[model samples]
Target: MIASRKQWRCKVNSCRHTFSVTSGTIFANHKLPIQTYLYAIALFVNAVKGISALQMARDLNIEYKSAYVLLHKIRKALLEQREFTTFSGEVDIDGTYIHPAPRKANKKIDRIDYRLKENQNPEKRCILVAREHYTAEEKAKNPLYRGAKSTQVVTFGETQSTVKHFADKFVERGTRINTDESHAYDVLYAILRFMHGKSQGRIP
Candidate 1:
């Protein structure tokens, strides 16, 4: 579904409250086309290396902070997408530590050794993306990444909220979910059961 059609809905089931995706987002009141935001995501994914928000805004024909908000939203959507898609069947997970790019020096200075120790890595991130050999093509159509299954983006946090949300929207209840030995999934039982209730009216 397109983001333009996003409806305000509460994250909690017990509440009948409704809210927009922007409710808790940085782009809440911004006046811009949802497509522009989508484009920002495309740029982030397609960028060979990191690109500044200013460059993104220039390329997308939008404001600099608009670009920043767009990037923020893209990351937000990525998190949601990753949360929804549970890794099942021969899942592969990994982590990476990215080093900060060297700042441009005002003037040439003597070279100084400033490297991290052997075990002390730079800023690290945990990625949680999944794959299913049978559902690869079908899942690729998901709006989040819209890329090939081999490169489906991963996410942070192990809460079942996202997995359950995905199941409620796509996967059928009782449809077994698979994952690595990450104990994070231990919380899925209740989430899965809760989602099953939400899926009843939608799934045939």
Candidate 2:
């Protein structure tokens, strides 16, 4: 069979790395030809009952272990493909806590425990998420940001600089940003307004 291998190149200007289809993948060490591996994975994903390595091996006439490994590899790629990038338009910013249980060891009898137990709580990092439809003007002005747009992840912290960085990266300068009256965002509106001044856009 004619093996057709996909190739990928690093886009970073500082680094140049050319790799085959199996690069940075679970299949990198497999001895099977690239074409066969791709076909097996496609069939496995399409299987109605959810294909197992043993089933794939029986169907594709390959080793059971190889089929299992390939399935896991595809699963990783599926996850990485679903990562969130940015947001636009009337965006909503909010934070939710994901508290991890506090850990404590056995205390010695009558020993003075002087550790900051409250500070040791694994504070869940903040999350910012938003989504909006793509407009004609936005697509024209920022072509790179245009697409069948979906959700976005926002930044954290109570500093203007942090908010400014998030605004620059996700929110276009002139778009209306809908957020609560958290003191952290007091200057966010003004900073975004300043950035919009340079572009003639208004905070909606």
Candidate 3:
């Protein structure tokens, strides 16, 4: 006799174990209906900028905890499982200071807060980005041809030590490094025998 949809029964003499559609799959032990899974997947796939767990919870009419777990499982499956290679060839690096969003206005207080001003705030965070430039031949064969092949994002102060540390960790020796006229990158000259190119203005 044939088994039901996604259901199976072992015919072995020692065991006649039964299992359902979710057996041995990521969807195993799921209480929600199959249609719910399909809908959730469609939402995730169709989202252009990506969706948050709270948004998914609202869309699926499910609890936040369930939506959070479901989203993580889906993300884990979609991520590429492999080792990352260090960046080589021409590399561009830059740093920028990111400020937190302004706090919401309070009806109780009418006075402006001077401490949160741009110049007065010492809580600004810095982000350093390294992008590897690709050649025409590399672009033609690469799946992601529109942008840099490898990128590293580091969160630290934009200082000489930070820049040198980032270069040592992500960039290969003897590789040409390109950046705007920033004194922080001066350390690269002493650390490695790299071809350093400094631009007069902002680099595209």
Candidate 4:
């Protein structure tokens, strides 16, 4: 530890790496004082309707551009570090293709069946969306959580692997997942079951 700079240095003879407590944190390479970041956080949290860059600039006495950039950085850090709470209650899942539609050939003889697996585009992808609804009873208990409690977006299509991964990561045991009769959802039933055997109505 370098007491003068309050930084740590690694020494391996051939390799030397220097870092500080905030080296990889949001405060990394920060020009403003550490207390300023805490004060900014306080302002951000207390803003009921949400604070604007101009407002933040006036409150923090920083440039509008600086406040804007800082606000976005804080938002990005929150998204990256936020702990995801799995959905509960009635859940609806659906997916749609996100790639270019198949194009027909110019000539009749040149035409090919694009519906075939071999003719499908390799760049094709699917965007999946899932939402968990809040019951009226639950909403009455807490009006703040009305409508959909949680929404999850899947970058890939509905498949065995994707279904299993989604269930294991973003869903709790015994939560009814409403999905179409796609073969992909078949795996979800097995995911929440005990080691001995599969449970009935695990996901319907």
For each candidate, the alpha-carbon lDDT, in order, equals 0.53, 0.60, 0.73, 0.73
Worst 10 residues of 3 by lDDT: 190-199
Rank candidates by TM-score, best first: 3, 4, 1, 2
Model 4 poorest 10 in a row by lDDT:
190-199
Tens-digit per-residue lDDT, 56-121, candidate 3? 999999999988999887876665442346677777787887674456467648545645665344
User: Please, what are the lDDT tens digits per residue for candidate 2 over residues 114-175?
Assistant: 35565544454455544555577777888887445444343343455665666667666666
Pairs in clash, predicted candidate 1? 8-19, 9-19
**RMSD (Å) of each candidate, 1 decimal:** 14.7, 12.0, 6.9, 10.6
| lDDT tens digits, residue span 52-149, model 4 | 98999999998999889888878778768745778766666666676745678889998988788788787777766667777887778878874464
Candidate 3 stretches greater than 4 Å from native: 1-50, 59-61, 70-82, 95-127, 140-144, 180-183, 189-204
By TM-score, who's the top model here? 3
Q: How big is the positional error of residue 146 in model 4, measured in Å on the Cα after superposition?
A: 6.4
Show pairs that collide, candidate 3: none
Candidate 1 regions with alpha-carbon error over 4 angstroms: 1-27, 33-35, 38-51, 84-88, 100-204
Per-residue lDDT value at 70 in model 4: 83
Give candidate 4 misplaced runs (Cα > 4 Å). 1-83, 105-108, 139-147, 190-204
